[model samples]
Target: MSRHAWIDASAGVAGDMLLGALLDAGARLSVVQEAVDAVAGGAVRISEREVRRGGLRAWKADVSALDDQPPARTWREIRTLVTGTAHAVFERLAEAEARVHGVDVAEVHFHEVGALDAIADVVGCCAALEDLGITSVSAGPVAVGSGSVRTRHGVLPVPAPAVTELAKGWQVLAGGDGELATPTGMALLRTWAGVCEPLPPLTLDLVGVGAGGRDPAGRANVVRVLIGTRSSPIASSLAEPAMLLEANIDDLDPRLWPGVLAGLLDLGASDAWLVPILMKKGRPAHTLSVLCPPTLADPLTDRIFRDTSTLGVRRSPRDKTALDRAFVPVKVGTGQITVKIGHRDGVLVQVMPEFEDVAALARSQGRPERVVLQEAVTAARETGLVVGAPMVSVWAGRAER
Candidate 1:
């Protein structure tokens, strides 16, 4: 799928409003329904129609709240709603977040951003993209206005703590008087926007204007989403993608390399290593290399500069083609284990337990980790483990280096 997507934070975005616009714009109802189905436990009523704004026609989504609603949910509860979405990648991303926060993914409730309506907004946006027949999307730079917004959590600061949290590594322009973006809006965009810099190249197909309810003077409170076609093939889609970030080091503590590698892995680096080369005759130096996802390039690279003696990092993009990949959930001896499965044309080609999860399971079970690992392997061989699943990949932290 040469699909691309983008988000526009013109006059700020709220869960309800964006959902409304997406519904109006023509997002798929089924995808939206499936996403939010678990949040409400049954289903939330919704309707959509083409709406006009600024003399331009667009689709808008209307969420029908139930006659009865659940009690005001805590942050912990909100987290579960998305987890319950049942989509592998979504769930894994939620869980990966738990890993980042040092909490069970299920335990980290979503606060105001995770409410049913917010969930509906996300689902609606997902669906609308499907309905729009938009294979690729490009958005203008977001304008995140300055100032604070109130929430159940209390009178938090402007941009909101959640919005600030989600803005990490994202290029957000701040200029609006107040409330140019909402947490839910940022969350969906961060998860879906494959890249956030200068909009990707594309041939304009149509322009979607999601009107913000407010009418800012001289500026329309409208989020403009451009649906378009790529002028060229999405090469990144085919390559066995890898990122190479290099740095020159001459004056760092040698003792930090191991921790750096561990730190990189913790921070979502695919691979990190050092090359010993003589910078000058008799002057031995090292070239540090970090291979990671495009998304992870910035944070982990930042870690190298901070933890090591590197002054800067240089990056080169790379792609490698490989067979399709999958994941399996296997019933090990006493606990379940997740295995990374690779495939070619629906055939199981390779399987391996995620060492980290296996190690955790073994530690909990009071058995040699290898034993738990072996049992998982055996289970996979016997009748095959659970089918493939997506995972959340994050570069959360770096070890002491």
Candidate 2:
């Protein structure tokens, strides 16, 4: 079964909290320390201890710098210091800060987040995830507490500018009385989480609790992480919470439909389609629907309004399930074509030549598209790539046709 990690940020999250959680969940301390030291060039040190927040047992990670006053770093300089996933996390953090402050990414100063401790927290967390063999990560809605917080820039509102900037497209809630989610926490979540939703079906393997610095009144100051494998039959398949946006349009010109669909797809809609419908008074109309990640709902809704005649759009949360799929390249004449394979329960169930690839090969070889498609299928089967007898029969019938 494929491994997945889910971050429970109901109480909020911070860099140190994340690192501690992973450590509490059984990540090797030595592995995390080695990666942090290598990335920080011996500038930082990490330590951990068991603690209780609101009577909940957890781990608290402490990271410190060798120097009394660490030098501030630019995005480029920080990128050079970290490698692999850690580097990617910092890159995203820098981009978000640059956008919020309206400066070039290279000119964005790290300030508090640029500190050695923060660097160790980020790098160490990434290392822990790698060591735990987490293939994917998801998080619940983030909590951004109320009140003001002090920073090098002076007293800023809680959530901070960097946190707000990073959480633009995400679901965030206000809670507690102080800063809950920090810039480092938001950056790490934005970089690692593929989806922000409630927990999915999983077989519990382990749970880790990471305590925040303070235990606020009447609440647990901790972040919980649930690491496990999916329990469903299609564990390796793609299933995510999506938003379905639909609008009924009767007056728009038919010519604009294609453009609207294309625009939606370009704007990151997973799927867009039109459905014929009978409106009130028996009038003929079309229901325009776009299925996209929940984060894209608002922007895409605005696009629908701008591009269609509908005055309102209906939005609903949907669960989208898809097969585990991959592309395998096959030779067609002198050109290489990719065959799309779909698997269910680790067994290949469907295989088809990508139409675009088949058509391109047809054009280059001066042959009919059908001929090129058949040749690709034959090659796949002959190479022992065919997964099941049923698929072979289906392909054999297509070859005859």
Highest TM-score: give the candidate number: 2
lDDT of 1: 0.60
- Give each model a TM-score: 0.54, 0.64
Candidate 1 lDDT at 139 equals: 45
**Per-residue lDDT of 55 in model 2:** 79
Candidate 1 wrong stretches, greater than 4 Å:
30-43, 49-57, 68-70, 75-111, 127-140, 203-207, 228-401
lDDT of 2 by residue, 1-401 (tens): 44678899988989999999999999988998899888777888888999989878999988889988998889978887886667767777787889877999987899878888889988899889878877667789999898999988788998888889888878999977799999888878877775588987789898989989897778999999999877877565667899999999999999999999999999999999999999999999999999999999999999999899899999999998887565767666678778787755434578787999999889887899988889988977754447652221122112110
Alpha-carbon shift of residue 222 in model 1 (angstroms): 2.3
Task: Please provide, for model 1 over 1-401, each residue's C-alpha lDDT reduced to its tens digit, 9 standing for 90 to 100.
Answer: 24444556655665555665555445566767765665676557766666555565555556765634534443455544543212322333344445445776566655444445655676566555556654333345566777676766566567765566666766777756778777666655555443455655656555556765555575556665655555654332356667889998887788988998899989998778889988866788898888888988989878987788777889999985665454556677667777776643223446777999889998897889878888878876653333331111110110000
Tell me the lDDT of model 2 at 350: 80
Candidate 2 overall Cα lDDT vs. reference?
0.82
Q: Quick one: best lDDT, which candidate?
A: 2
